[model samples]
Every structure is written in C-alpha cells, then in structure tokens.
Target: MNVTGWQRDALLAVAEVVVLAVILVMALLGNGLVLVVLLRRRRHHNPLHLFMLNLCLADLVVALFQVLPQLVWDAKGRFPGPDFLCRLVKYLQVLGMFASSYMIVAMTVDRHYAICCPLQAHRSGATQRWNTFILLAWGLSLLLSLPQVFIFSRSEVAPGVYECWGNFAESWGLKAYVTWMTLAVFILPVVIITVCQPGPAASSAFCCPLPKAPTARGGEVSAAMSKTVRMTLVIVLVYSLCWAPFFSVQLWAAWDPDPPQNGAVFTLLMLLASLNSCTNPWIYSAFSSIQLYGKLINILCLVCLIQTLYFILYM
Candidate 1:
C-alpha cells in the first residue's frame, strides 16, 4: 500500500516525537544524576567539580527549556501559546546553549590551570574563582542571547497556527549571526579545549606532587591520571564531532540560500547535537569508580549505539 503524503508526514512527525521523548528523558535524568551526586559530595567541591556541577545545571536547563518545548511543539504541530512565550522559548533556548558551551570552556580553562600551573592553581582560591566564573558564564550567556528576544517573534505557520523562528531584519544578517555563533560558541571552544589538553607527565606531576615518592602507588596514580586525560580528550573529540555537523549544516545554509535536498541528514545532525548534552554525563560515568553508574553507562551506551546505527540505516 502506498502511503499518502499527509500520512507520511504524520508518521515522520510521530517518529520525531518518540525520539525526542527518549532524548528528553535521558538528558533530564543523566544531568540530574550528576547534579545530585556532586551536590551530595559538597565536601569535594573543587573548582573542577564545581564547574562540572554547573555544566549539569546548564544541561538540565537545556533539556527542560529547549528540548522539552520542541517535543511539545512537535506533538502539537504548532508553537503553542502567546507571542511572549514564543519569544521566551527562543530566548531561553539560545541562553541554555550559550551557557552550556561557556561552562565547558570554563572547565577546560580550570583543568588547564590545575594541570599546567598547579602552584598558582593552589594559591588562587579556586572555589571562589569558579563561583565567580559561573556567575560570569550565566551573565555572558544571557547577554549573548538577548538578541533572540528582538529577532524572534511568533510567525504564522498555517491560517491559525503559529511558530517561533528567527525573524532577522535581513537574510544576510541571519547568516552572519549564524556564522559568528557557530564559530564563537562551538568551534572556538573546541580549539581551546584541544590546547588545554594536559600532558600525562604534567598531569602526573601535578597529581602526585612527590617526584621521588614510592614507585608503585605513584605509578598507579600516574596511570589513573593518564587515563583521565585520555578520557577527557575522547570526550572533547566526541563533543566536536557531534556538534560540527550541525554547525556545518548551518554554515551551508548561510552560504547557500536553499535547504539541502537531504532533509533527513539535517535532522540527524540536529539529533546528534542534542545527544551531546546527554552523552557527557555518560562519559563522566565511564571514568568514575562507581560500579552501578558504570553499569548504567554501559547500558546507555548500548542504547545510543543501537540508535545511532538505526539513524545511519534510516538516512
């Protein structure tokens, strides 16, 4: 039986709803778990952990304010509510995205200082500095996202249906903004993260201060530090890969005034970007000692792998 055009659209929409629901659930729970674990261990509030906690908070905000609304909007087939809410959704989503990106940059900076300049890191009162940086992250994110408030308004989708999308003064203006945002928010951060990669020797030296100490325990500590560095490197690499496609697609759209012929590819890129928010917690769990969390991470990894394979086949 041949599927009618509207029927195919409805089925595709339903599939999006299902996938988005799964993403929403994982993002909320995974990030919430990180927050709970960190907050419970308040005594271990080093600057790195503090920044990580903020990352969790920022991811949760994205899951709630950004992805959740998209899920609802998908199900309802329109941007539900008043003009104010449409603008608010657009604004908050951009804010969450900026906050998440900036927090990662802060973490990279904090880690760089800790590993590369331990003496200065020890003297700087990290807890206080990180707190200030967290505040700054939020402030900067809010400021950066302020343009969304002015650029986005409710536009008619159908006769009675409305949706929120960027309403820039000119196409070139929107393209310019996309290009700038993609570079500043995503590409630049990845470059900074790569530069901040702590060498094994430096990390070992910073972690195990006594250079001439017992070889066995020191070796183990050094090994663990090296493993952590490797894990962090992989996490950053994954982050870059996951986000690069989405930004590249946006850049293409900016240059070529037409949408790509392969719409599914664009959707898949977006899904991968959303998946990044959920994947970070699992990446953390993979490097953690908690057996239960590690098991959960393995299970989640399997699920994600299966989904990824399905996405590949579907595309």
Candidate 2:
C-alpha cells in the first residue's frame, strides 16, 4: 500500500482504539456503580431490581469480554492471544450479548404480567416465577453462545502472521451465521419487547386492559410499577437504536459481495453500539430517585471532563 493508505489505516486504528477505550471505561464505571449500589441495598427480593442487577452484570461482561478484547485487537493490529483465549473470548463476547438482550426481554415480560395480569402477578410464588425467568435468560444465553467456541479460533492468515478468525464453510456459512445471529439476538427479542410493552391507552384491540388500583397505597404501588415499566421501555428502545445499525452492517458485510467493510460510517456505527452499555446505567438512574440521579450525573460529568482534558492534553 501507498504511504497515504498506510497513514489512513493507522489513523483509523487509533480512532477505533480511542473510542473503544472510552466505551470500556464508561461501561465499567456505570455498570459497576449500579451493581454496587443494588447489592448494598440488598433488594434482590424485588424482581425488577434483580433483573437490573443481572443486566448490569451482563453489560460488564460485554465491556470486559467483547469491547476490551476488540480494543486490544485494534491497538495490536491482530489478535494477541493463544487459540484457547481466542475461543474463550469469542464465546464470552456473544454470551454477554445474548444475556443482555434476553434479560431485557425477561424484564419486559415480567412487567407485562404485572400490568396485564395483576391477579397472577400478585399470586403466591411470583418470586419463583421471576427466578425461573432469570435462569432461562442466562441458560439460553449460555446455550446459544456455545457455537462461538466452535466457530472462532487462532489461525495463520499469512505465512508468518496469525489472528483470531472464524472458520466457515465456503459458500453459505457466513451468510447463514450472520442472519441467524441477527434474528436470534436482535429481531426476536425486539419483537418480544414490542409486544410486551403495554401502551398508556390500552385498547382491547391492542394491549390487555389494565386493572385499577383498589386503594391509595395500591395507587402508589401502581405508580412505582409504571415507572419501572417506563424504564424498561426506554432500555428496549435504546437497545434497538444502538444495535440495529450493528446487526445491519454485519448482515450486509456477510451477504453483499462488495460490502463497505472499511467504510468509516459503518465502522463507527459498530463501535458506537457499545455505547448502549454505557447508556443503560444512566437510564436506570434517570428513572430512579432524584438523589440517585443527582449522584449519577455528578459521576458522569466527572468522567466526561476527565476524558475531555485527556484528549486536549494528549491527542
């Protein structure tokens, strides 16, 4: 390649590294704080809080397994680990994605049950039901992500150079894999979330009729439940917005003969999909108490200010 081409490639790598670094830090800090706070409060009995805790845990896994490894790969210009590490990382990366996606779906389904079927939701053993949902979410994620271990491995791409890559059948393997991932990870979960999110104006034609609260205390309970439902809805919307471009690009690159694999826009979209992890904690904070929201805002401002100063001084 020419000097200009080499320079552009180096610049893009640097940009990717910087972006991933920022995402990794934000995701870690945001999710870590949420986890700590929730655990300290010892509110696992609240099914919503239990889901939030697991969601944060899943986001942390994405930061560590998915984004961190990608950052390292970008900085090094290749995978810098053994075949085992490569396979493990790939499995955990997809595992985190699946866990995060299905956790949201499970949470939404819980809300749907509470709002639409109050009698069942308030029945005995509801906690057991929630626990079952959480277990299924994690179990399915583990099962689905096992394919990554078989698919990705360290391989010699050149005479002397090795990198982590996927082994696919010659003709249709990649296309099928990407399509299945998009369907399982993105499309199906989105459809489930959309159907579960009850509208404010519940018509019999669309959502199940919402039950009325019987007393003032029950009204307050309903309001709190509504807040959580709203929070879950925002999470679902943000997840879709952030991940749609990523899966779309993956599908296009898999199927299109002349895909824009090196296009700046597509690359940026994929990288910024990690921003969903960063935004999730803030979304939860926003829907939480005012005091918690204030604290989170302070933390976020401090992070942003530090990042800005570092860029100004070093970049």
Candidate 3:
C-alpha cells in the first residue's frame, strides 16, 4: 500500500509519544532517586555528585519543557508556535543539550581525578579544586549559549514547528548560533575528548606502579581505576553514539528541508536520534549499579528502548 509521508509520520509520532511517556516515568523515578540520594548525604559530598544531580534535573526539564511540548505539537499536526514561543522552545532545547554535554565532560574529569590520581584525589584539598572546575563547566555552557537565544525564533514557513538552530552557512540570522554550537558542542568538545583520551592511560602508567614493590592496596587501586576508566569510556561512547547520528541527520535535514521525505530511512534516522534522551539514564546505570535499584531501572529502561524501537523497525 502506498503511504504518504504524513501518514507514516503520524504513525511514528504516536510511537514517539508512547516512548516519551515511558521515558518520562522512568526518568522521573531515576532522577528523583538521584535527588534523594544526593540530598540525603551531607557528609560525603563531592563536586561530581553535585554535577550529576544537576544533570538529572536538567534532563528532567528537557523532557517536561521541550519534549512534551514537541509531542503535543506532533499530535496536533501543527507547529502551533508564535515567534517568541518558538524562541523560548529553542532556548529550552539548547540549554538542555548544552548542559547535558558539559555534565558528561565534568563527570569524565571527576573519574580522571579519582581513578588516575588517587593521591591527588585525596591530597591538598584536591576535591575542592575540582568543585571549582565543575562551577566553571556550568558557567561556560551558559555563556556559550547566550548569543543563540537572540538569533533563535520560529519560522512562518510550512505547517510544521520549526525552531531556528545554528546557521552552518552564511545565513546571518542563523550564523551566530551555528558558529557557537559548532565550536562548543561539536568541534571543541570532540577534539578535547579525543586528545584527553591518552590522559587515563598515562595516569595508569604512572599510578599502577610495578610489581617489584607490591603494596597491599595497589591491586585494589588498580581495579578501581580500571572500572573507572571503563565507565568514563562508556560515557563518551554513549554520548557519541546518540549525538553523532543526530547531528548528521540534522545537518542534512537543514541542507535539504525535505530529508524525511527522502525516504523512510531518513525518517527512521530522526526517530532513532531522538531516542538518545531516553537512553541517557540507562547508560549511567549500566555498570554503575551500586544498588539493586540500578539493576531494576536499567532493565526497565532497556525494555522501554526495545519496545520504542519496535514500531519503527518492524513497521
């Protein structure tokens, strides 16, 4: 049977709603637990933990403020946005995305310090130093996104919700956003992630210490560092897995406004790309499951992902 793009999109949008609903429930529980856990402990506070709490909260806002509204728009089959409203949507989205990325970087740094430099992690008020760095992360993300707020608004084009993002080319209205987003979100972060990759290895080389003088705690430290390394690597990998396809698909869509019309494949790509937001909590819980709570939530999140992907893959 021949199906129109709108027809297919309608089906997919329904599926998206289902998935978003499931994710909202899980994220609320998972992030709510995060808030409880972080807030409960006053004695063992650390900067990384604080950042994670903020991360969960930010992700929660995104689901509520941006995702829910977009879903409503999709259901109504209309953009339903005035220009100022569009700008507000754009701001919420950009802020959420930037905050998430920066939080990942911050978490990686925390792991780097804790596992790689155990002595430094403890010595000379090192924890406080990293806390300052975390503040800088929040600050930089906010500062970087300031220019895009003014440039982002709704377009009066087709009958779909269109919020302005960065202009990759010479579109002046979109230029400032394009420049900053490219540098901060894509270019600089990826480059820094790649270059700093060697840091953990180098730290291990120095910290592992030869068996010629084995201390009792040496093995324990090595194992801890190893797990920490694996965790950080997964964090980066997950970030890339989710965002790369999105950026690629989005770039193409911007160049060719009819990308979803190019075929079901492009539409599929968009569907899969949006799944990342729903996937973040899972990634965090994957190996970091310290309690039975993590195990249950991880499994539940996985089931949600599989079910969410079913309509797209099977249909």
Best by TM-score: 2
Query: What is the C-alpha lDDT profile of model 3 across 1-315, one tens digit per residue?
Result: 457766876687777667656756666666666666666764676554566667776677666666676676656755576777766776776666777777767776666556555565677476686677677777776776565567655654446536443333455434344444656775676666664553646566545343354578988867756765676677678678867775666666555535664454565555443455555555555555435375566868999999989978998
Candidate 3 total steric clashes: 1
TM-score of each: 0.82, 0.90, 0.73
Once superposed on the true structure, which residue ranges of model 1 sit more than 4 Å away at CA? Answer: 1-3, 157-160, 200-224, 291-315
Model 2 RMSD in Å is 4.2
* Residue 134, candidate 1: C-alpha displacement in angstroms: 2.7
Q: Write the per-residue lDDT of candidate 2 for residues 1-315, one digit (tens) a residue.
A: 699888887888898999999999889988988888888877544887788889999999899999999999999999999999999999999998999999999998887877777776667468888898899999999999999998999998999999999999678999999999999999999998887787754324454455655675887886898788789889998999999999989988998899977767778888867888888888988898524556667888999999999999999
TM-score of 3: 0.73
Error of 2 at 146 (Å): 0.4
Q: How much is 280 displaced in model 3, in angstroms?
A: 3.8
Q: Rate the local accuracy (lDDT) of all candidates.
A: 0.77, 0.87, 0.63
Q: What count of clashes does model 2 give? A: 0
Candidate 3 global lDDT: 0.63
Q: How many residue pairs clash per model?
A: 0, 0, 1
lDDT by residue (208-278, candidate 1, tens digit) is: 35334355676785676566666667667777887888788888877886876346556656656777778
What's the lDDT for residue 161 in model 1? 64
- Of candidates 3 and 1, the better by TM-score: 1
